[model samples]
Target: MANNNSTDKQGGIKNNNLNKTEEEDEKKKNKKIFIVIGVAVGVVIIIIILILLLFTFCRRGSAGETEATGVEMTEVMEGSEETETLEDTSGASGETSSETEESTEETTAEETTGEEETTETEETTADEEAIAPTITLATYMGPVYSSADGVCYYRVQANVTGTPAPTIVWSRNDGSGLGPNRAQVNLHSPSETYTLTATATNSAGSDTESITLSWGCNRPPTVHEITLMGDHIAGVDYTVSAYATDPDGDTLTYQWSASGGSIANPNINPK
Candidate 1:
């Protein structure tokens, strides 16, 4: 019986040792699982903190850019207002200068117009004064021979001056009619004497001038011969000539009378 009790006690001790070894292995496994969970949680917390810092940095940058843009806009607005104010002031000054220039030009134009009117009035007043007419007679020969009518004539002319234009009238002492400002007398004999008078009349005054004229003797012209040339047929042309001379060295004129046909160039000496 003693030997059997001792074997039983040894068996109990071996079982107790095996149970403690198993319990220690279980505790080791639990500790390994807790360490793995703690490491995973720490990695997740670090990732979340990095994301918050990035978001804060981005917000600060955006705010700074917005403030800089606002400042630039304010500066641009101030510059625009200054430019507009300066332009308005310059425009007002220019208007004032233009008004002054216009006033000066108008005053000068009025003064010039007044001077021209004064000059015209003075000239008109000077023209209103009156002066009497003065008469002057032109010198002429006593007798002159007319070749066209074969007659002798005495002629005189007068010149007159006055403020207004004068009308001249001529008269002869022998009760003969006369031309304007001139007297022409036809002579039938060489012993004739004539008194010529010129009278100038105007609105201002009147004047008279007188002259005396006498005629000298002139000799008559004598014809030497007359000749006719060319065919005397009715439809043909013929030329006629007259040979004549004067004793007093006067120019002689010829006249032709035709009973039939025609005469060409009647005023010429050769016909």
Candidate 2:
């Protein structure tokens, strides 16, 4: 009986040791599973945060790029507008320069024409002045003279020096004018005074001169009779007598001329 009791006690102690080892193994497995679940939850949360940050950054970068593009387009439009304005200003400047040149040319032409006209007028005046005429001399030739039929004749002369020869004209105080060098008059009275005028004329001017003359008739003495103092023969000496008469009673003196003979005193009283 003592041997059987000691064998039963040893079997009980072995079974209790086996049960404690199994419980320790089960506790270790549960601890390990809790730790793995905690680690997985933390990894999932970190991935979600990274995705949200990436999306926000992309949206900000796109907005910055759009603003830069709009600024570049605005600068290009302003540049084009400035270029067009410059072209318009250049065109206006060209037109103004052309107009100025044309105006200057017209002014020069007018001045040249005016100078030509003035020169022509001056030349014409000079020509007219050069062609003017002048008179030199105007006078009478001599005194009046009487003719056989109680007619009178007078002469006048004139001379001129100029571009053209001058014409001479004679005028009498009897209201008669003629173009002759000599003038004729019939005197009804014994004596008459006459005034004669001569005029010298040309293209430029004229000159005049006058002369005075008188015409008259006077009777002359005539011898009536004569008597010789010597004989009619030659070389004979004798006294002589003479008788004389005159239509005009005036003092008388005698002179003798010999043709072919000689005498001592041909003008002695008759005996």
For each candidate, what is the lDDT? 0.78, 0.63
lDDT of 1 at 69: 97
Residues 91-123 of candidate 2: C-alpha lDDT, one tens digit per residue: 799886888799999999999999999999998
TM-score of each candidate?
0.32, 0.33
Using lDDT, give the best candidate's number.
1
Residues 122-160, model 1: lDDT tens digits: 887765776678998864644666666655677677877
- The Cα error of candidate 1 at residue 70, in Å, is 56
User: Against the true structure, whose TM-score is highest?
Assistant: 2
Task: Give every collision pair in model 1.
Answer: none
* Model 2 residue 124 distance off true place after TM-score fit, in angstroms: 5.8
